[model samples]
Target: MTVDDIDQELLRLLSADGRRTFSEMAGEVGLSVAAVKRRVDRLREIGVITGFTVKVDHTKLGWGIEAFTELRYAGATPVSAIITSAFAVPEVQAVYAIAGDPDALVHLRVRDIRHLQQAIDRMRRTGPVVGTKTLMVLGSWNRDDPAPGPVSDER
Candidate 1:
């Protein structure tokens, strides 16, 4: 439950690249390979490290547009219903139910502007959605990137 400095370092390395070997992590953390493995295993057993994921370039995979749509529900729409409506559209990558004028925000990846419009239309028609405003992403930077720019520095 308590992650120490070394465990945090290991997590940072793994987040940057899930494929990093335990041996490499050991060298970075100044521990033996077996020790590093044991620590990583414990991290998983205690649920600190639930799983690993791969970073993808959607543009390379034919999804050329990424957008975020703010959704406004009519009144008292259940969170489950909001999630269900967004998930029903395959282009939706994630949804956030937040505390604001807009009840939810949906992240989507689509082939083009027309596809984005269609996905947004579906979101409105599926649930108690009363309104939606979409903003196209021109560029993005993630801290999980192995070699990120100056904006990623938290130190």
Candidate 2:
């Protein structure tokens, strides 16, 4: 489906706040409410708007630690098998099969350091996992947020 400029603007607004009302979007984009609704419906019909989701603070929900574990598997390990092994551990949030030395990268959220270590151990023990390297997340920034302006030094 071809997404025109108006469609692009609608998408950006919806992505920033999924619960934003159609009327508000219509006002922002200079279109009638019904027109905005129709455009949005068309976007969904074409599968561009697959679904809406809520972003949560994992730290507030008792998940104090977040980490990424790079997994190296045997030469013959299938991608599906790797995904299955990672998903078996409940803490595994996302699994990315990449094209490099490490076969996959697994995102995990856990309650504490001990929980993180346990999840890593579980992954290591599963399937044809040859090696695993985990990196702890200290902070993160999303592109959706406004970028900081250039730094200046003057006194």
Candidate 3:
């Protein structure tokens, strides 16, 4: 599915704020409401736009503790199995099978230190994970932001 200028503009706008109405988006992108709706529908059908979600505050929701865990697996071990197991645990927020020194990097949010310990213990028991190094998140200086694309002078 090739995305044209209008589609790209729609995506940019939606990425900034997913909750914007179709009519509102149409006005900004200089397209009719129905046309905008059709483009969005097509984008979703082609898997360009997956789904919308609401961002939440983990601290406010009582998940105060955050940790980053790096797992080193055995030689030529399949990391997918480990990742699947990690995702099943409620405390796990994100899992990445990195290419460098560590086999996998996992981000977790827990209610307290005890919960973090339990999560680590469970992961140790899971397949092929030889060792893990965990770092407790004290404070985040920067929040996660999507990579901005190249500047265009279409407008």
Candidate 4:
């Protein structure tokens, strides 16, 4: 469970490109392919590396509208109930347990403004959600094509 420098390096490489061959990663990290594979498998086993998948641009997929909704619930609400309500709607992509005025923050994607409104309405109708404030997303970007945090000589 203790991740060493080599393990961090392997994680960084895989985060950049999950499909990168172990041999290719070996060249970058100065390890044998088998060694890299072992580290990666261990990373998975220990839950450091969970699962890999393709990233898609939601806008390009006709989901042109995105929104961040801050949900307010009555006093001392359980987070599991909040998550369950959000996940029941397919438009909800990510849920954040917030620390401020709002009980939770949710990132949602929809085909258009109408769809966004519908998703918000659905969340509001959920039993424990007292209220919600939604903010429209203008644009976004990702740097994960080459993920940060290199395993430098600091190890």
Best by TM-score: 1
Task: Report clash pairs, candidate 2.
Answer: none
Residue range 97-122, candidate 3, lDDT tens digits = 98977999999999999999999888
Off by over 4 Å in 4: 142-155
lDDT tens readout by residue for model 4, 1-155: 59999898887777777899999999999999899889899999989988998877777989988889999998888888888888988999999987878999999999998898999999988858888999988655566664445555654
Query: Would you give me the overall lDDT of model 2?
Result: 0.92
Better of 1 and 3 by lDDT: 1
Q: TM-score for model 3?
A: 0.79
TM-scores of the models, in the given order? 0.92, 0.90, 0.79, 0.85
Ranked by TM-score, the better of candidates 1 and 2 is 1
| lDDT, residue 14, candidate 1 | 95
Name the candidate that leads on lDDT.
Answer: 2
lDDT of 1 by residue, 1-155 (tens): 78899999999999988999999999999999999999999999999998998888888999989999999998898989999988999999999999888899999999999998888888889988888999999877777765655665357
What's the C-alpha lDDT at position 13 in model 1? 93
lDDT of 2 at 97: 92
Each prediction's whole-model lDDT (CA): 0.91, 0.92, 0.87, 0.87
Q: What TM-score would you give candidate 2 relative to the actual structure?
A: 0.90
- lDDT by residue for model 2 (1-155), tens: 79999999999899888999999999999999999999999999999999998878888999979999999998789899999999999999999999888999999999999999999999999998989999999766675545657666759
